[model samples]
Target: MFGLTFEKLLLIGVIAAFLIGPDKLPHYAQQLGKLVRNMRDYANGAKDRVRDEMGPEFDDVDWQKLDPRQYDPRRIIRDALTDEPEAAPAAPSPNPNSAYLQHRAKQQALATGELPPFDNEAT
Candidate 1:
């Protein structure tokens, strides 16, 4: 359950058997099983308690939406790579005297070390 594959778990069992020895192995195994069971029971009991305290409205919550794993990089890249129609580009303004052009001019002047005439009206 903790990302352990069958081979890794078998290797761990062999090591444990060797370290613990055959005589006390069953006792230790039983204890380990009991510990796992108790942990699962405690988790389930806590979940039940939280659900009881929160009431029926909690059942309607979109749990997947709240999960942080949904924002994983793999999912984000997959979504971006899908063949969705691109969003339409914004229409260009016909007016040449737009504030953006003025801003660009100001930026060009600043790049050339010539400050654009500052308007006192801006104050």
Candidate 2:
């Protein structure tokens, strides 16, 4: 189909006839016809094979279901993601107090490093 037109082909044929003369045009045409026939047969056979193997299910299936160009892969993945819950934003650290509490902790540990009587040792 290659955008071939009757006028363009006729032009090509006129040139071929002049260049190759009346001796080989018929032979080339026959060969071209055979090539086209073989291509059509191959395509038909492939289609028949798929239809036979897939059976009624294939026939009944919506054609759009098989069209890769029209499929939305994201829809399936998005559905799967939506099925899971967002982890409750990590429970904020048990101790929300920062700088002051952290410093007090360090001081407590240091003052009681090797002693048991240290709950009131810092004072």
- Against the true structure, whose TM-score is highest? 1
Q: lDDT (CA) for every model shown?
A: 0.73, 0.69
What candidate 2 gets wrong by more than 4 Å, as runs, is: 68-123
Report residue 46 deviation for candidate 2 (angstroms).
0.5
User: What is candidate 1's lDDT per residue for 8-89, written digit by digit as tens?
Assistant: 9999999999999999999998999999999999999999998999899779888989898767553354345544523432
RMSD to the true structure for each prediction, in A, is: 11.1, 17.7
State the displacement of the C-alpha of residue 106, model 2, in Å, after optimal TM-score superposition.
36
Residue 54 accuracy (lDDT) in model 2: 94
Supply the TM-score for candidate 1. Answer: 0.56
TM-score of candidate 2 to 2 decimals: 0.49
